[model samples]
Structure formats: structure tokens, C-alpha cells
Target: AGLSEAGLDLPPMTAEQRRASLELWQRRKAAVLYSVANNLATVAKDHAAAARVYGQLLTLDPGNSERICAALGRLSMQVGDLQSARHHLGRCAQSAPAERRDFYAAQLAVTSADWATAQRLFRSALDSNPGNMLAANNLAVICLYTGQLREAIRLLESLLERQPKLAIHEGLVFNLCTMYDLESSKSVGKKTRLLETVARHRGDNFDVAAFKF
Candidate 1:
């Protein structure tokens, strides 16, 4: 009684055809879910709900779509789900454009306190885009945290030399002043001059006025 057996101009679907049909259906369903998740995330501001929906979509599509994986990764991070963020972001990083993958991977590494990996990825990102001020700033911060003061100073100095007008340059200058203050070899006059420069750029908001040498 089936339509194929009844010869009603309908041919039996092959196994491959059936598999393709099911995959298409799943992809359509995943698309709908992705839309709903985005709406929940952006319009409703329900990150938890959006993450849940995205998790479901991942179950359907897995890593077949890089955008979906990247969205899930970002949403997971927003919800403090570092483990899930690492998983999804790792997959996304594998397929992301070369210019951006290292940046995304570096952020994930930071969440895990993997400073070495983060440094490497951030450096890679900067190497690919030398004008990436954010990457330079982040790498400099990591260098400072790890007590690589000379490297940190070099990074900030290079950035300033290239783009002195960048608003974030003030922060770099402040960090440089702090490093100079900590180094006994740096003369008091030099430190004072650095602090004055920072003060000029940062105005009254510069807190180094109370910092004792």
C-alpha cells in the first residue's frame, strides 16, 4: 500500500537519499533553534536560555558550522561555563580565519590561567596583525604579570612609537612608570619624569601621585 509500491509515479528513496533527507531536516531544525537562541540572547537578554538552546543545536549540528560553534563558545564564556567555552571555542578556532583564530584561542587560554598558551596565541595574533593594539596591550599585561618587565616595556614602547595618539597608550605609560618605579637601577629623576608624563595624559585621574618611591 506504500506509494512507491503502488507505482503512483513515486520512486523509492535510496538509503543515501534517506540519510540526506534526515540531515537536511536536522540542519533546518538547527537553524530555527539558532535564531531562537540569538533572539533570547540579544533581545530578551536571557543568556542562560540562549546557552541552553545553543547547546541543543550543538547536539544536532556539532562542529559542522563554525559560526554556531563560535556563538556557543562566546555564550558559554558569558555564563561562566569555562569548560564548555573551551570546548566550543577550540573547535571554532580550528576553522576560524587565520587572522582571528589566535585571538579567540588566547582569550580561552586566559580563562584557564594557561599563561604560556595565552602568551603564544596573543603573540601569534600580533604577528599576523602588527597594528592590533588590543593584542599588544594584552600581551604586555601578560609579560608584566610574569615579571618579564623588559619585554613588557619593549611592547609598550613599540606600540607608543607606532601610535602615540591611541587612547589606551595612557595605560601603557602608567604601567611603564610603575615598572620604572620598581627598578632600583632607574634614576629617581627618570621615574619622576615618566610619572609626570602619565599625569599629563591621564589628568587628575592618575593615582600615582600618592604612590611613594
Candidate 2:
């Protein structure tokens, strides 16, 4: 599709480049435009435009519609657009692979504050694939919200221990520390231990502020 030649495969670093990519996308409607859309959302931080491009991709690349829908769903969530998140994530779950359907469905449940349904879906996703850190993290959140504090703590801690790479996950660390704060008055010691553990695993790349100590 001449994508590399047009620089559409690379991140557009400036507004002029982004405009050029958008113009090309409007004219081409190629599935390769996903790279441009991803860079627009991730690098340029223009989520609305990225969502628009992904919407177009749903038609241009029906074979990857579920993936595009998932991207749009996450973008909607990041922008606090719960209505759109529910719509897109539900679409994703409808056609996504069996192994991935529950995660998208769980994300859809989150948009409506259906914690019980979300908990069930996320737990199912994690059970099916223990490497699904997002599913595990969300399930832990539902548990915490449902007043199962110890269960939440155990889930996150055990997952982190099993997958040390999760030490760099900001949301997981923050939520775990929040649980520690709620579970006991002696939370600083726990947070300190968490910080040490993460530091040991990730060196200096992990943000210290995520622990909220």
C-alpha cells in the first residue's frame, strides 16, 4: 500500500505530518491506516481523531473489526465516554476470539458500573488465561469495591509475585497500595515493601508516585 513510502507506517511527530496522514487516510481508506490511527491516539494524544480513524477501519478491515472495536472502546473509556465504550466494547466481545471475548465483555460491564457482572467476566478471563493482567487487575478492583479487601490484596499480590513484569503496571501497584491503606492503619510499611519489590524488579523505570507513599 506504499504505506512506508508515505510515512503512514511511522508515528506522525508533528501536526503537519498528522494532517498529511489524515488526508492520505481519507483518500486511501487502507487497513494499514491503523498505524496512523494508533500514532495519532498514542503519540499525538488525539484520541477523538484516532477513534474516527478506527471507526473507518472497522469497515475497511472487517477481518480485524474486533481489534479496531477494542481500540475504540478503550479510547472512549479514556475519554470518559461510557456510552461509546459500552457500544464498542460490546461489539468487540461479540466477534472477538473465544479466549478474548470475556475481557472485552468485562470492559463493557465496567462502563455501566455493573461490578458483579464485570467481576464474573474478568474472573473468567483471568481463569482462562492467567497471563491476562488486565483481567486480573480489574477483577481485583471489583473485589475491593465489593468489600472483599483481603481477596483483592491476595489476587494482586499473588499475580505480581507470579508475573514480576507486572511490577511496572501503574494501575495494579496503585490499587494494591490503596487496598493496603484501606485494610490497615499500618499501610506505610506495606507500601514500602511494595516499592522495594518493584524497584528490585524494574530498576528505576517504575514511578515511585504510583505507590502513593
Candidate 3:
């Protein structure tokens, strides 16, 4: 009946032949769905519409692929559909490839204010790949948020030492300055030097009034 509805004639066939035919039909349907979703995403730039089409494709494939979940997760995040983003990104994190999965899921968790999960994911990413500077920086931020100032300082300092160019990173410098101000009574000279260095890097357009010591 389903094949007939799609204008396919049923031929007399063995069980294996019928199974192969159904499989082919399902594959063709999935290809069509993927094409439509790509067109919606690229041509129309309609993230929501593309996400819906991907959701439909997921129903048909049902855990057969993680690419669809990842795409849908990113699209949902772009559209501010946090619930859908969490669901799809969580699925992707569990089933997809390792590269960037934990980082992206942690980011989404941060957006949702699920601080514990974000911290856990960031930490997990760091543990899995100790060279992940982004994960280390994000975890350091969580430590700062929770008032683990010393830990944040240590983490950021380690990062900056490993890549001294990171000293020019505004966020890292800001956090370092804050930590120094809060933890060190003798930080006035150090803070002044840090700000001066930043100002030098930024050149003439840098407004001294914008920075309050």
C-alpha cells in the first residue's frame, strides 16, 4: 500500500526481494529529505524550516545518523529554541564523533544556565584532550564564577604561559587583572602595567576613559 501510494507497482517477489525494495525506497526518501533540508538551509536561510525537515528525517532514520542531530542542534541554537537545542545536542554528544561534541554541548548547557553540566562537560573535554585550550578556558571561567579564584588564576596562568600571545586576549587579561586585584595587595603596579600593555596594543583609538583602572 505504501509503495502504491508513492506510484510504485508491486511486482511478485521473494521476501528478500521485497525487503531490498523497501530499503531502496527508504533510502531514496531519505535522500529527498536531505536535499529539501539543504535547500531550505542554504537557499532560503530558513533555519526553523530546515530544522523541521531534519526532525522529520530523524523520525524516518531514527538514530541511524548523528549528522542530522548535530545540524538540527546547531540550527535550534541559532533560532533560540533552547529546548530543542538541548535535546538534539545532547543526542549528538552521546552518539556523534568526539571532536567538538563535548565543547558544543557544554556551550549549550551554559546558555541554558545548567552550570553543573557545563562544568562537567568542559572538564570532560579537558580530560579527554588535555591540549584543548578552549575547554580549559571555559572551565576556568566556571571556576571564576563559583569564586574559585585561585583555581581560575592557576588555569589561566598556565594557559598564558603555554601560549604567551594569549596575554593579548581581552577576557583572559580581564580575569587575570580581577584575580590579581582581589587576591594580591601588591597588585597595583602589576595592574597598571597590564592595562598599559593592552592600551599599547590597541593603539591611538583606545579610549583611556573607557577603562576604569
TM-score top scorer: 2
User: For model 2, how does the per-residue alpha-carbon lDDT over 100-201 read when each residue is reduced to its tens digit?
Assistant: 998998898889899999999999999999978888888998898898999999999989889877888877898999899899988999898888888877
List of clashing residue pairs for candidate 2:
none
RMSD of 2: 7.6
Cα error, candidate 2, residue 84 (Å): 1.5
lDDT of 1 by residue, 1-213 (tens): 544323465467899986786688787888889789989997798988898887787678866567777787778877898998898888878878889899888978977989999999999999998888878888988898898988987886687666654433545555666666665565477656555555556567644543345
| Residue 171 displacement in candidate 1 (angstroms) | 3.4
The per-model lDDT (C-alpha) reads 0.76, 0.85, 0.76
* Pairs that collide, model 3: none
Kindly give the stretch of ten consecutive residues in candidate 1 with the minimal lDDT sum.
1-10
Give the residue spans of candidate 3 off by over 4 A. Answer: 1-9, 97-100, 109-213
> Which should have the higher lDDT, number 1 or number 3?
3
* True-vs-predicted CA distance for residue 30, candidate 3, Å: 0.3
Worst 10 residues of 3 by lDDT: 203-212
Q: How does candidate 3 fare on TM-score?
A: 0.49
* C-alpha RMSD by candidate, in order: 11.7, 7.6, 10.5
Best-to-worst order by lDDT is: 2, 3, 1
lDDT of 1 at 67: 74
